[model samples]
Target: MFGFGIPELLIIGAIVMLIFGVGKLPELGSSFGKAISNFRKAADGKDMIELNSKKDG
Candidate 1:
């Protein structure tokens, strides 16, 4: 992803550490996970709008 190799990945990780700090890694990871989950649900048309429409009819 993003055409990164080992060296590039390490550099990107270092930048993230600088930006977000080690103490916030878990919070960032969890929020990223939730965003990814929501993106997948949206792509599959399984989000709240779809559920509500199904219920109304």
Candidate 2:
């Protein structure tokens, strides 16, 4: 997507590390993963509320 290759990705990653710092990378990755998961669930019409309640019980 956007014609971004390995070089472009490396540059972008370096910029992100500079801006957010290495310590924050894991947090950022977790947040990104959650966002993608939520997006997929919403697109598939999955009910998160019910799933959460079921898991708790």
Candidate 3:
């Protein structure tokens, strides 16, 4: 998995925290989760586009 071990992940996490700050981490995590969910739905051909349009209308 891209050869990322615990030390590498901790370094990456520290970088992200420095950039986004602790206060916004929760918001960022939520948005990231939603993006992943949408990506999975799209990969499964779930017609997300139509569903979003229907909700808006």
Q: Candidate 1 at residue 57, lDDT?
A: 50
**Candidate 3 RMSD computed on C-alpha atoms after optimal superposition onto the true structure:** 6.2
Candidates in order have lDDT scores of 0.91, 0.92, 0.92
The estimated TM-scores of all candidates read 0.77, 0.76, 0.75
Tens digits of lDDT, candidate 1, 1-57: 778899999998999999999999999999999999999999997885633445555
In order of listing, the candidates' clash counts read 0, 0, 0
Which has the better TM-score: candidate 1, or candidate 2? 1
lDDT of 3 at 20: 96
Candidate 2 whole-model C-alpha lDDT, 0 to 1: 0.92
Per-residue C-alpha lDDT of model 3 across residues 1-57, encoded as one tens digit per residue: 899999999999999999999999999999999999988999998845553444554
Please report the candidate that would top TM-score against the real structure.
Answer: 1
lDDT value, candidate 3, whole model = 0.92
| Candidate closer to the true structure by TM-score (higher is better), 1 or 3 | 1
